[model samples]
Target: MKYPNGTKMIKSNYKDNFTSKQSFGNRGMTLEEDINATNNYYVETDRAIIHKKPTPVQIVNVNYPKRSAAVITEGYFKQASTTDYNGIYRNKYIDFEAKVTKNKTLFPLANIHEHQIKHMESITRHGGISFIVIRFALYNETYFLQGEKLFSYWNDKLKGGRKSIPYQAIKEEGFFIPFHYQARVNYLSIIDKLYF
Candidate 1:
């Protein structure tokens, strides 16, 4: 009788002396889920705090089939107004977005929204560590491209360059985030090396 609303009260790794890393991970879990697990692990270990911003929604209609069970029938995503994940870590601010693509050769810059770019800019203005973790699913490679790097190339594209960031560029300009058991993405390691 477990209805998957994702609001389930799952225990965090910090609850007990859960020192042992869990082998559990999303079997074909979306990149978002993998990042969430990693963030959960970080939060539990008192390492760093990061969270996915809730998707904005505009609820227009609802149906109350039962007194306690009202269902939303008509609604739409209010366009995302900010970056995907961000928070404070070790008394410093950390901001980032996670994107996954099936492409092998390149990552289309078009896939990133302008608003997200602006948000990352704001975070940088405040002296925060900002980055984007891109997963090239086709090659099973994940790279953490610094916000400054992305911004530089983004401006390059605006000044009449390639419409996309080639994978070779990413590999050369970005750091590979190591994957872990409980902390699936383990991006903080990359952050530690590149930022801290």
Candidate 2:
């Protein structure tokens, strides 16, 4: 896989010409990539302690080259990630998922996986700040939807006829995350305004 900038992202495939989509298709980078960049900036500036959740992988086949490091030939990921990012800020536990879509009207509730919902619920139960950073890719707007609000909307949609949450509904329920150069998402500022 290669980033939009043509840099190799993931491990190479055997086929020389095979190049899977590196980032989620929308603008140039995925929501994950954007969040990661923001998090890296935060860490470098000592503004926050958030980090992307690392997936555990087991390497089976490894080839050691002459006078060099070993290369992993085969591996298996253990499980799915519960959340995109989580860490401490001001001694408070924070957890959140980052997502994006090209849809202009609404963000489909189905985009959020059930396990991720459960994980967010768990974070809330433990008194942690849990939310999701959602991007309306076409409009270039991002919102931080709190976990409870997300669950309510998800349940309501599931029990009735609605298949997606309208942008206006999200605008009312979710906090608009301000864009910034340092902390790109700047979600904590929203949290301070809404939940703190």
Candidate 3:
């Protein structure tokens, strides 16, 4: 499968060497898996209630062998999703999308869709906290960029501005998520500092 950055994700022959407890390093686990683990930790601890939204699928065909389980033979996405994760934290609604890029210099704006941007804007308009979690996989750094800041870049791009947000700009405007043993992404710590 190809990642949003247009790079194909090949099955790694080294995957079996690492266990879940030892997968925090840059090459060990993917950004998505790390964040999901972190969210699981948060839920188990009752610190927050966040979850990855399941992609809606439209099943076109199914097959059933006699007295056996059914299998989906064909399916397609129902529609474009708004974001990846959403839930409540500190009595306020929290919503955000997570993305990973191998690019070291800039995060391509094309990684975000227009409808998703609008959805984030709506969240902010309704008093919910909205942001994006971006991981520069090559650098092993994750950042939380607020929706307003993202909108600035999206707007600029729409007006013929730069097509990508420079890494330096993100470093300046975004909050760095510290990695920890219990919380892999540790994004709630940043939310605590920024939103709480």
Candidate 4:
């Protein structure tokens, strides 16, 4: 099976050693899957209505099969997306992009596009909540970094500063998201503390 982040989950022979309560394998679950599960939990409990935006696909051609449904012969992404998730929370608009990096020292700013940065800036300008959920897969840690803070790093790069946000800087500026069994990322709780 593949996780939402497109990582394949390998079947291990050591499954018998793990308890039912255990979550993930030695590599852990992808950030995308955890966030999706968290959003589902939020929606189920009426806490917030959030969902991962589906990527727009342009169908180029289709083939009709004799015994099965039509198959897509060619397709392409319509465009690069602005963010991963967006929704209403406590009467406020929430928008954010989720990103994961395996680097241990820094998060390369190029992972985020210029248009996405502009979109985030627009959201914050209009008084909506915007941010990025960056996961350091190597460390198995995720952090919630506000849009404004992200812009600072982005702008710095444009001004010939560092082209990445160092891990130390993120640890100091971003809030660590706690992992839970049900909520997974549990980022909304940090949002409650930070914004509400």
Pick the TM-score winner: 3
Estimated TM-score for each candidate: 0.83, 0.79, 0.86, 0.84
What is the per-residue lDDT of model 4 for residues 1-196, given as tens digits with 9 covering 90 to 100?
1235434335432232233223363234567878988999999999999999987789999999999999988987776657879999999999999997878999999899999999999999999999999988767888999999999999999999999999998999999998888899899998999998
In the range 23-82, model 2's lDDT, one tens digit per residue, is 232235555666787788878878779999876778899999999999988887765558
Q: What's the ranking of the predictions by lDDT, best on top?
A: 3, 4, 1, 2
Q: How close is candidate 2 to the true structure, as a TM-score?
A: 0.79
lDDT string for model 3 (136-176, tens) is 86677889999999999999999999999999999999989
Q: Residue 173 lDDT in model 4? A: 99
Better of 1 and 4 by TM-score: 4
Task: Output the better candidate (2/3) by TM-score.
Answer: 3
TM-score of 1: 0.83
Each model's number of backbone clashes?
0, 0, 0, 0
Q: Which pairs of residues clash in candidate 3, taking residues 3 or more apart in a chain or in different chains?
A: none
Q: What is the lDDT of residue 15 in candidate 3?
A: 57
Position 113, candidate 3: lDDT: 95
Off by over 4 Å in 1: 1-27, 64-66
Return whichever of 1 and 3 wins on lDDT.
3
